[model samples]
Target: MELRWNPILETWVMVSAQRQRRPFMPKESCPFCPGSGKVPDQYDVYLYPNDFPHLMKDPPEPSIQDDDLLRVERAFGSCDVVLYSPDHTASITQLSREHLARLFELWRDHYRAMRERADVKYVLIFENKGDIIGVTIPHPHGQIYSYPYIPARPAKELDSARRYWESHGGACLFCAVLQKELAFEKRLIWTNEHFVAFLPSYADYPNEAHIYPRRHCGSLLDMSKAEAEDFMDGLQRQVRIYDSLFGFELPFMMGFHQEPVDGAEYPYFHFHVEFYPLHRSRDKIKYNAGSETSGGAFTNPSSPEENAEELRKINAEL
Candidate 1:
């Protein structure tokens, strides 16, 4: 595997010939379950190295030569899997509060390790759940990827935050967004002592929701002990909200965006979690055709207010 420069989009694309060979929905055995050689027999939350990682610490030479137009480079990075539980059928909502706390700390530990690496620039914590989200393993788990450079989405967010900070006399953009959303109160799902979950007015998905720290901070390390505990509560509640929305465990792509760990200051950047659920409603999925894929513009057919209300009601009931 190697990284190829996409000049048009001004991004690096991972070219991996190995990922295609990964197992599909396996029928017989699961490496994450107990009694499997892949993991220990006893553990609540565990960190396992990805068996098939796209990037590595010391990558081999690229098979294809680099050209002036097609700039190629070694994919210097790391990917780790954070197993939430050994139970083969456990979901986020099923995990205990103490277990969830341990899982969050496991993610924090990996992030700190990757931050100290000289080759790493950004650390991303994310999870893909449900078969609709193309989850190869049904076992509940999340993954962390340390990239050699800041990813496109996080880079764009940083740029925007920096611009806002400069123009608004060192004011934070994300804080302003949270203030606006809180004032409106139409898109809000829930707000704990330290965090808030809401659907942005300009949500790209029909039922999209976001979790943001109430206090402006660069990363999870900035969170206090109480703040961190509340954050975990918000996470567990969010998953429960999604599961109760459709009366089933909903499939979604979740990612946490924070400050880049390139030994640079990012005070303007704020910590937040963005969730992109694949299904819009019961037995229906929102597909990215034409405008979303070709034109790079997302179109949400449903009303954000209505969708947010649905989740808010379910969240309150639970």
Candidate 2:
């Protein structure tokens, strides 16, 4: 099995075809279980360096200098897992405000710790929820990954934002988008003094939502205590609304994008949260068939506007 870098596509393609045939179990013994060898049962939150890392801080072995046409560079980075709660049944959205705040505290701490490493430039925190998303463990947890190089999606966004900032004499692209959504209000779900959740006009999924700090903060790592508290409050409320919309505990992939932890500052970058759910309705699932995989196009069952309206109604009733 090998991983190849596709320079034209600007992505890493895992060349292991057998990986698609790997066995998956919904009830497998979780390696992250407390008192299961690595950690004790009394821990409410656990953070450990991953045994299988995509990148390591240590220098890599000599590269195989094949033909110049087929060059391969080592992708060095680290991956770690964060146990969100002691109770495996609880999800991030199900966490109490206090527990959620503690989680946020750890997030901030991890960001600082990873960024201090000279090899790490970008740090990403995200979660894949439910077995449908290929998450084997039922535990309420997420993963933290630190890369020596900026990731493709974030690098592209940063470039675009930097260009926009230069053109506008220092302006945030996301802040402008947030202003537009606030004025429109049709796509707005909820907001407080510090944060807002809204469905973007150019949403890629039926129920896609973006949560952002109202202030033009660079990243979650830089958020003040008050701002962090308000952000968590809005986050929990949004999750409840999502669950109510489907009349069940909703499943979604949530990720936070922040400025890279490297010493350089990104004045144009604004911290934000993105949630993309696979389900379009109670029974309908959004499957990314060949079109999405091969052509980079999407076909959503419901319009973003309609979905926003439905979400708004549910949020209000809740």
Best of the candidates, TM-score: 1
Q: Could you tell me which 10 consecutive residues in candidate 2 have the lowest summed lDDT? A: 13-22
| Candidate 2 per-residue lDDT over residues 202-299, each given as its tens digit | 88787899998888998776788899999888878887888888788888888889999788989999999999988988888888999987998877
Model 1, 94-148: lDDT tens digits are 8777887888788887888888999999999999987877789888899989999
User: What local lDDT score does residue 7 receive in model 1, on the 0 to 100 scale?
Assistant: 88
TM-score of each: 0.98, 0.90
On a 0 to 1 TM-score scale, where does candidate 2 land against the true structure?
A: 0.90
User: Which of the numbered candidates is closest to the native, going by highest lDDT?
Assistant: 1
Task: List candidate 1 stretches off by more than 4 Å.
Answer: none
Scored against the true structure, residue 214 in model 2 reaches a CA lDDT of 81
Score candidate 2 by lDDT.
Answer: 0.80
Candidate 2: clashing pairs of residues: 55-76, 55-77, 56-77
